[model samples]
Target: MADAAALPSEALTPPGGGPGAGPGPGRAEGAEGLFVVLGAGLAAASHPLLYVKLLVQVGHEPLPPTIGRNVLGKKVLYLPGFFTYARHIVKVDGKRGLFRGLTPRLISSTLSTVTRGNVKKAFPLEDMEHVSNKDDMKTSLRKVVKETSHEMMMQCVSRVVSHPLHAYVSVLLVISMRCMVQFIGREVKYSGVFSAIVRIFKEEGILGFFVGVVPHIVGDVIFLWCCNLLAHFINTYAVDDNFSQASVIRSYTKFVMGIAMSMLTYPFLLVGDLMAVNNCGLRAGLPPYAPVFTSWIHCWRYLSAQGQLFRGSSLVFRRAPMQAACFPID
Candidate 1:
């Protein structure tokens, strides 16, 4: 997912203008609208992978494990990969099933982007051109810290504002009659968004809409800091001075760094999503799949003990534990 909260400072600055020249209201609104559309499109395209991944995360293994050779050439149980899981979903719910829960995901993406843009306008970061221009180590470090801090604050505020929508998406993904229940067995089925919202409010109360928000925010913060700091250091010190002239390469460095940081911080995201649906009445969230957790921390500890903190992270080459061993082949 795009880090809507961490929109580049240059994006907020108007073309042919400096940091002092704020983006024109019309231009800013247009840019945000464009991003909303783009985000929705991206979410739609990626929904299948996310759907299958979420089911995997919740321990809903419909397909039996198959025996495969590990990297070490030992017989090991390999869980269904992304394509296998997706094909199974199609078999059950048809092609349209892959897009289940997309409505709320699009809404969440839009709200997050708009909220971040508005919050950024209200609390614009100070321009660091002077600090950034200086090649001194201390100045570069200071600039990075300032930039990361601004990003962290914006992300946290936006997350808090739009988190209820995220919770809604999680519930929808896990309880929709046409989606989640198709994998984990029919338990509780929500008809539509409004009905689901009312039921969640009644069953889980107001707190239901904010479940697992803390860890999500923390993960974002950590990703921002790590990605920004490392990118800054690499661009400033590690790369050749001439490398800065390659604007295209320089631009991609941050994206690559972000991906790396995301992998490192993915466990937090997994825990956050797990906690959002845990004990929320879906069979996937209840006993036999997962135990009731006292807190997100407890959820984290439980998954850690089971070595499942990274479950569903990989779409392919998923090696299951020996305890789950099945269908061994010579």
Candidate 2:
């Protein structure tokens, strides 16, 4: 009786507690707790309008590490997995398929100018030309535009160079997610998160990766457009020197902005999610002249499910690292 009682007490007490033990269960639980907190916290901290709002109002201690990464324009996650999936678009879909979303990429790049691109820094030096006219506005404008173009070029180069691995993981993960979710109601129980990864390795061999590319391209292009457009509009219109910088207000506003963006562009992401399953990568995933409503609704349901599964850069087995400072209002 005493031994049984001790088992329950010890379980409640945490893993490595008896006065002599170091951290075992306690540490594991703490780590998981920390991860959950960080996940939510990182999302908020990297959120600019929120960060600005907090700064203006509460005088918070400081932003989280993710926020710092955002300001510095460095992506925190490696997501070594998804990049592998990128190759499938190249290998199976051919050259055009590999770069399927070029138009969206261009659109994303142009919209990016509003926030991170700051191409305005060049063209409209009228706002701050008095501070330093040592450089001509045209020169400044040229440089900024050139830099923005260069950034886009750099991304393309990187994608091309790392095409193989990126294709592999990305393709596999996308298909795997759709499959697992469909398999959700069955006895296999969708294999949980960490194990889903391991199971991918065991079951699909090295080839499970190509399946994820189409979904990734779809999700990313739409996500970029939505996120960038709203952020751009907010900065261009809503944000200004006076009231726009409030941290709490900005934080909440950013959250809402992200949500609005999500809702608006979610269907595209949904289509991407569904199309990811058919990723032999041989053809463009979308069919020509398909019934608009059927495709859209189909995309929406799948996307909604996936969104619930991987909310805000959060994914189960694979993840997209928080991108560069996406929406910096004012």
Candidate 3:
């Protein structure tokens, strides 16, 4: 999957690619980036399990009161509850509704991934061969610093470039859903990615496009740093020096690390979604209400007041395994 996403950037890479090349290569690279992005979008949109995962994450489970019962205290007669949420989704919005916001998510994630990949490829790091010496801890520390620097740089570039799409994905996946109306005091009737783009832009302007971006960027850098450092620790102390044994240990560690990282960073993700949802407007002619937060700190205070810093964490736990599975793919 990473290879497919990187194909365009690699194709556009100048012959004998080297660090600090001229900006001319960057233009070709940008255009080529679109192909990989489209491919990523399709892949993300078509994944079967992702559909169910997304629905669950967006508060689609357990049936809302509107669909669960009627005013007379009798079972609300509705479609067969066999595939409860799936049936509800079809009944309410048709089959195509299951794919809501797929385009925005695809664009956001693909751009983020492609941008990071291009940056990493364009500025290849010097091989850390010197870090192999066991006699010096300085070499190990240097290696960690080098890897973290590259990763931080990639993440910063990717997050900035992808902020709009990321915001769109969050809004589409969770914000646009009426489930959040109780918290946000607004009902966003999702009309697909294009409609969302226009509405958010018109209502909230540039700032709306970046709600929760600070936490997202900060959490991303922390997650990457932790993952790299954990891998180094595992490689150094836990795993034996045997090549095959070390390889197996490394693989397992990475999977475990991915889930751990996801769990740790989930609060930031939750906060970001909340901020975005709160900022977006749904009803027309409302003159666009003020956003709930002026900054991530303000958002944190609001969530703290509500005691929902870890709201809907069960979905994140359910989602972690998939995150771990995709670790290598990214």
Top candidate when judged by TM-score against the true structure: 1
CA lDDT, every prediction?
Answer: 0.69, 0.32, 0.52
> What C-alpha lDDT, on a 0 to 100 scale, does residue 165 get in candidate 2?
27
User: Which candidate tops lDDT?
Assistant: 1
Query: In candidate 2, which residue ranges exceed 4 Å CA deviation?
Result: 1-37, 40-172, 175-179, 182-208, 240-255, 277-330
List, residue by residue over 1-330, the lDDT tens digit for candidate 1.
322222333222222432224468777677667767776787678777877877887888888878778778887778889899899988987998787777766666677778777777898777655233334879778877887788788778777766676554453322322234335655445556677778778988877777888888888877888787777777665566466565555556677777667677778888877787777766777888889999999999999999888887787888776677644466
Candidate 3 local lDDT, 1-330, one digit each (tens): 011121122222333432333367676566446546555756565532344433333333334322234466553323223254455656666777565556665666666667766887788787554243356657786787787788678777777677676445353333233222322222445546667666667777766667667776776776667766776777667676666666556555644665566666666765655555554443211223223466777767765675545544442222222322333321
- Tens digits of per-residue lDDT for model 2 on 1-330? 011110111112222222213357676446544543443343333222211211111111122222222346754432322223333324544544333222222222222222221322233322211111433545544543443344334333332222222221112233223222221122242223345445545655654443333333344344434443454345334554366454334334434554555554433433433333332222222222111223334545644553432222221123232443354523
Q: What would the TM-score be for candidate 2 when compared with the true structure?
A: 0.31
Order of the predicted models by TM-score, top scorer first: 1, 3, 2
Off by over 4 Å in 3: 1-84, 129-133, 169-198, 242-244, 283-291, 304-307, 316-330
TM-score of 3: 0.64
Candidate 2 residue-wise lDDT at 25: 61
